[model samples]
Target: MMMMNKPNWRLLATAAVVSAALTACGGDDGNDGNSGEDGRPGGEPATSVSTLNLKVTDASFSNGLPVFTLLATNEDDEAVVGLQGLKVNVAQLLPAGHQVVGDPTKWQFAGDDSRNGAAEIVDQKNGYYTVTFTSLDKAQLDPNFTRRLNIVSPAGTLIDGTTEVPNGQASFDYNAAGAAADYTRNIVATDSCAACHGEGNGIHHGSYVEPETCATCHDGLKAEGGRTNRSFAVLVHDVHKVAAAEDADGHIQYPTELSSCNVCHETSAPAEELAITEWGNWSAVPSKENCASCHADNNHIMEQADSSRCASCHTAEGTGVVKGTIDAHLGEWNDAAEVISQWGSDVEMAYFADTDTTTVTVSITDANGQKLAADQVLPQIKRIEVLTNLGPNYPVLSYGAGSHLDAVSNGELANNTTIVDGSFVLPITGLPYGAEGTDADTAFSFVGLAACSKGNAIVACADVADPDNTDNYTGMKANMAFVTKSGFTPSKRHTDSLEFSKCEGCHNDNWQIHKGYHSGFVMTEQVAHDEEGKVIGLDGCVTCHTPDGTYAFNNNGAWEQKLHVVHGDKNIINDCTQCHTSFNLNAFAKKGPINTGAGANPYADGLYGTPITATCASCHSYPSAIDHMTGGTFGNGVYDVDKADAQLAVSAENCFVCHAPDVADHSNVKF
Candidate 1:
């Protein structure tokens, strides 16, 4: 099963110290060592200045103090000595508006960041210096300040510098102030939003590139009498209006009336952008009117009842089968009825060109619940199609099946719930279903043969021939010829090998509704109709509700108590300073030798909790089958009744034999 391709052979063998080869050493900003090619520390002196790279350890805070780590290194070509006299200064910039809200004097600093005006040198001999500060009060620095640092010689001659670390832009909140203005007639430029958001992969989804990406579809010269012809605003507003359903407030608003600016505008790349928190439920998602300013007549505004209207934005021509979505059952031809005409309702027919030694049994029954003769059957089904979305006509038919297949039993066709066991056994041979021709060895290609047959005989025989034209069988399904190939291979065995049990772990139906809410999705049954077609029946929180659940019991007990009892009492002993922020503590924070906040669990330090796996063995590992002990030697709970007391007799310290506690702090204390 582990087929190692030639290109990956090196990855299986080489264990290098570094995963990537070293590239040219970019200019040292005094933060990098200036080692010469010979590897010795010898180098010509450019200057005695040293560079220090400083990084903030804290991520985000509304108004709390920030944490930082300072790393100092000699940037000069020569390794200088006597680093003990060096001085580092930290400062911040106050935006003009912020100056009016807070004291400007609080943003200034005097000496090194340390309270004592001294820095701890980890590798001082190597020009390494570090300092930590929990408050700007000590250095007279601003809490909201964003700026750089300057390292100077003891005499005040500046040695090195760094770029400014700008404060997070709290004023440009898309959800709050940004949407207050109505640019209904004028369009906001996507380029203006992409300035910082497009730093990495400037392209996202299909044609949405940086700058001109908005013009890919929104340049509205295609229509007349439109304001700001290419306005994405109109397109978004109309789209939301069309998608939304009636609510207590009448027509539901999208992106929230307050957060409408975030429909296409975001702080980061489109894919990674934050979703509007107040956006209504997906079922209540507004319609095209919200987006008409830009994508005016996209897909001409498809109807919701007719799910096929969604094809305009989510098909191969649209998104090319986005991950986590059921693929459209209609084959490459996109001919729905033509697809149903080929493979009939019988799910058990062994597709032809099968090289694997697996048997497939198909059965067909008429309305009277009686098996019909293959020869006498006309307009009978030969295969079943699974669809993701139902159009106005319901199940769009899938194509490509032939009349030459055996009629097995009436029992198999009794119900839709019964998955054909025969289909699971037959491993489809010759080009796996989706294999493109490029991968010859791995791809399954169709052979040119009439494959579907009664029993073992292909229906291409003389008796089943058309009465009018004996030369050709009109019963032949379209495109069936293209699939009959000799040398095609399968990517995955075509047998019913996709297991639902594996899905149960993440999509448990009983308790957690991760698979039902907007976080996930689930489809119920495949409903077949007359003229409307077949459609997958759907019902779930994600379809109609918001992040919250439907039932009141879930909202009260399980949501609050049971969930808290299960995941609460959390303990994360990783960082001591998170809870005790009167002192700074973070991954990048400079640390002191004192154990003042040592081993203090941050999660347990707070009131919230995190979820832990409820594996059977987590609480049960004892040799005995029955014991109430929380933890003991060899195990925690008894697995055997006879040995219950025996395992408990062993000292509690013995529990570490197999069940180990986190080394930092194991005491079961609240504080």
Candidate 2:
């Protein structure tokens, strides 16, 4: 159950008409109105209930009837009443099968998500409720058998009763004796999905957050659309495997390689308790239903193995060299995984004076950290380019050919030849930024290339493949380096912060998303094994996607907006914690709006969105969602912008009023 340590907000919201104190929430770049004396927005206290936590404490099944008892409480541990519109379902926790990817013991579903009509609900109106499911087949069920009760309630009907909307689930298991038994179906945790989809922000329009809750009803296949039945394996595999898997418009592009199975079936996190159980079931316990979900497009192979084929060729006994599901997908082929790690970048841009030029040194080194000789790996360098941007912060106002140096300006520079001394010094001659701002950094991103080395010999990744490793021929991942305006001290910029390892957790260190241009990464550090043991600090991508114009990298404008828009379309982005280091709303509120590529920056000339709304719109870009955003009913704010109104707008939405800053708040659902 959740507790509302927060102050009451309705009183404060009622105090003002200008306040957008509705239930809807927007994203980052919040231009906060007033840090009120009471430490809340607009000097308000949040006493009104925002979200309710339901606990299914006890469950019992006797003969043909099953009963589930629950207690509902608001965030402050206060008893919550009046929560109606319950969609309850009971299912037996079945054993895993081999023919299909479903549990056979599950029986409560009568199609659709809810089992309706035959429930006797007894609400004491004091947080307790006894729900008995009638009309259950006596011979099919057992009171002593392990069973699960899934209580799903709609977001409203007041929970003293409710003030905000949070579609959630309260599921518990029990035997006839009211004791815990063998109900161990915890294969993947909610955080696994939350790591990408944001917790409680996806599936059934965000109604069900827990995977176990989903499995209770979804274990068996049911016909949906025109094609096959909708099972957990079928729906999930289709949504993630291909571009048009779920979308009719075919706009969704799977972010990582389709073969990257371990992205979801991850075995370990940074800690042991965080580790998942039975993760290897994806391969070990194969099923025909699981294989056909994604390989429906591969007609020939599917037809050949049509008879309950659990990809038996790749199973324990018969497959060729590759063994299981994990062995089927290709691994990273980044040609320079080693050399790039050893190299270092030294950038010098003297910017106290406007006319001063900058110099950059690339100290290419061998695996031993010594300088590389001309005869060494240097010949393997097929391609290399340096990218620069005015940083220390993001929404880069200037860079490239056509710069949008708006309200924020540091200095000016152009592409010019430079002279600096090192084993290999490449320089850009430009006037330094005038701002002597301490730690004001200039971002420099590098993209280098080398053939996959065969032992110590430099060989083209394609040619040297005793096995075909041509995917490595393109570009090499490189580290991002930043330097202070003093051009002497190194620094780091404040961009969209995320754990580099977290990204690697899915994409792996060899990910070069840009392909020909290189995806730009190789894990130099591991959060699971570090000295200080930090899990954050991986800021990149904004350097090329700045407003200064890198059309190749930017379309929806700023990195903040683009990241959400791009990923949101593919899978899920509403869960901010998936990529964000933390929800530092105070810092986010002070940030600026995103430029939707106006003035020859080529994104849809002169279109802009307010920071929070723009980022929210990145994913919630439907007409209905926008109406909720522009305050059609909630509150008012001019979020959408045109070239005429080029100025960035301040935060005006009331998203935070509903989405309190904490781990438990439904709006900011961070796992």
lDDT values of the candidates? 0.25, 0.47
Q: What is the C-alpha RMSD of each candidate to the true structure, in Å?
A: 28.2, 12.6
After superposition, the stretches of candidate 1 with alpha carbons farther than 4 Å from their true spots are: 1-199, 204-275, 281-289, 293-671
Assess every candidate by TM-score: 0.20, 0.65
lDDT of 1 by residue, 145-228 (tens): 443233333322323332211111000111111111111111233322332132112233322322222322242323331113
Clash totals, every prediction = 75, 21
Candidate 2: global Cα-lDDT? 0.47
Per-residue lDDT value at 412 in model 2:
11
| Predicted structure 2, TM vs. truth | 0.65
For model 1, state the Cα shift of residue 167 in Å: 17
* lDDT of model 1 at position 119: 40
